[model samples]
Target: MLSRAARPALRAGAAASSRAAAPAATFATLREIEGRLKSIRNIEKITKTMKIVASTKLNRAQRAMTESRSYGETSNKVYQSAETKPLEGEGKKKLVVVCSSDKGLCGGVHSGLARFIRRRAATEGDNFDLVILGEKAKAQLSRTHAKNIVLNFSGVGKDVPTFTEAQSIVDQIVQLQGDYSEVEILYNKFINATSYEPTIIEGFSEEAFANSPNFAAFEVEEGVLPNLREYTLANSLYWALAEGHACEISARRNAMDNASKNAGEMISKYQILFNRTRQAVITGELVEIITGATASADM
Candidate 1:
């Protein structure tokens, strides 16, 4: 019922009013985007920091692993050259010493060992007792292999493991009364900076070492056999611990690096969305203002 000149004014005013409601919804969306952006930024920071820490530790761990490997191999050469083997049919159970770490965020380092033990248990039966070196493995293995755990040491692998620590652990293990035919030191073997696998270093019992087909060739002293056995056990344990620590650090660095990249990607997406939303809000406000001005002019 309005005249031609007033009709344009009324239409413009109605259009402006309709658009006025849009800012509220847009504001809510903007807030959510901002909140998400902040969270992603925080996550990126944390992951970056973790990556740095792991990188710092990786160098020292690798060095220690190298030294330990040399020492362990040297110590075991006598048994290897003597053609020693674990005595079977001796009516004794096997002992598996699991070397892992107390910490986590290392991407399957601990879980891999747990899975290996579980698979062994499933296929070979639970005839072995577990000596866990880390809480992470203990927690994972304890669910099913609780009764088989003989000794557990926590707070291990916090740093480069020393020979003294390994010797102390050996002292405790020797104190255990179980009659084990074979003592296997299970640990993560570092194949490279990026890959590792669970492996075992065999610890020959004193009887197995002495009864070797070629042991008589070495001319070892009468009382030196026991000392050699215990010394070799400690050396093997140190090697396993050092290698496992290196693998864990490498794995953690890779994991944190991936996490930081992913977080950065998320942050970029949210930032783009936030900027576009803000521009849209500004455009919307400008449109409302222009429309209102046009309506007044028409009136």
Candidate 2:
């Protein structure tokens, strides 16, 4: 099989085959890179869209939060003016209402509330019953403090919260009628566009409010106290929901913004690698062509 002249021709054919296979392999890699690039581009688009939506919602959420604050503040004055405090020395427990949302994608918005509760549980030694206002916190707190949950509500925090929603929640809370000394509404407080913290608003029981040291100054009727308590509960819940919504929107916008930035960085990096790889493939093809032409001329 080794006649000298035929051997050279066979070697040339084999070399051409090898060169063709190399280009095929390089093309396969190029296609893979292209697929990855497309996927990343799609993700970037989605994140950017989410950021825009959150930005739009942030303004409305802030407005709702601002409006609700007045209601809570005005209602709280009744207790503050009378110097009200939670009942003590009765072996009583407090009820904690955790205001979280059904939705996620905000940075630690739900987890922040959960963490706060866990910390309180650790320090307070489970002397409180939890009334979860959203599915998100319920799922989390249920794991460790499941026994402490007396009542939990769902289908909340989808949009800017309404007073009707707050009233409904307050109604359920009032109906619970547990032996709680006081109630606490917990929510994420909006510190700024980029910062938030867990905060609580204290709520006094009817007995506690009535027994205030300065209670005699107001001349309030016993019949009005029940209504006042319910109204105050509603007001506090509305405030918590609104402020938590604002915090969530702001955090989500920031999260999406960061995601988009990271995706852009990845896209830029991949683009450079793709361009270099493509140039390499072209150079390889040109080399193969030049080699073939030179071999033919030699023949």
Candidate 3:
């Protein structure tokens, strides 16, 4: 139906048109792949940076935890030797001081503490008051235990927790209006570099200490009892805070490391897919050109 020279040109034009449509879809897919790759690369960078930062802080946090733990143990030795236990005061509730942190991205550190509190409340009939030491726990517990939250402090565990911070927090806790029979400091205890669990250290009231079965064994001044209680409370809080900070840092480092590994795996997968799609597109174009040439030669 057409002249020979015209047929070749027409076939060439048809081939060009088909290629234009086909590669449009292929190119769109390629662009999407490129965008995803770029996004994943950026995420990997951010997670790597976070991991490095967490690793750097972990050493300091662990060192502080060791010192604080020793100090706390020494403070509690008197109560232990005195055989002091929490007294069940009439109409007095127990106080739970949760040592958490403001920053997140540290796998399950805050949530574990919150879950422990919820379980304790459920089992114990919600007879305890709460004092949260960080925004993360406050946010989590506020949803379920808002009424129980008597006091909360933010901007905690930003670095190695200092005695000043713990003392200030303990002072505020002591100032709380409730008649607390005993104080329990809840925190994440580091089991190892890769494992952690929620734990508690007890702080007894002066009255409880006075009534201990072995209290007669130690000689104390009349005014020193109250001071000792307060000092031990501060030391317990400092130990909890320092250990919890170390756990958070270690957890964050591990979480970021895992995230970066996952991102790398995804990038590798997408890159393979992108390359295959590109190769298919190039092959399709070549096939179209060959088919058109064959048809033109026959015409």
Ranking by lDDT: 2, 1, 3
Which ten-residue region of model 1 has the weakest summed lDDT?
8-17
Model 2 residue 198 CA deviation (Å) reads 0.5
Write the residue-wise lDDT of candidate 1 on 1-299 in tens digits. 77887777677768867786889899999999999999889989999999999999999999999999887999889888999998888558999999998999999999999999999999989999999999999999999999999999998988899999999999999888888898999999999989999998999888888899998899987699888889999999999999999999999999999999999999888899999999999998998788677767857
Give each model's whole-structure lDDT: 0.92, 0.93, 0.90
- Residue-level lDDT tens digits of model 3 in 94-177: 999999989999999999999999998888789899999899999999999999998889888778998898888888877777
Better by lDDT, candidate 3 or 1: 1
Report clash pairs, candidate 3. none
Task: Show model 3 residue runs off by greater than 4 Å.
Answer: 1-18
- Give RMSD (Å) of candidate 1 vs. truth: 3.3
Q: The CA-based lDDT of model 2 is what?
A: 0.93
Q: Cα lDDT for residue 112, model 3?
A: 98
- Candidate 1, 3: how far from true, in Å? 19
Model 3: ten consecutive residues of lowest lDDT: 7-16
Select the stronger candidate by lDDT from 1 and 2: 2
Candidate 2 colliding pairs, count: 0
Global CA lDDT computed for model 3: 0.90
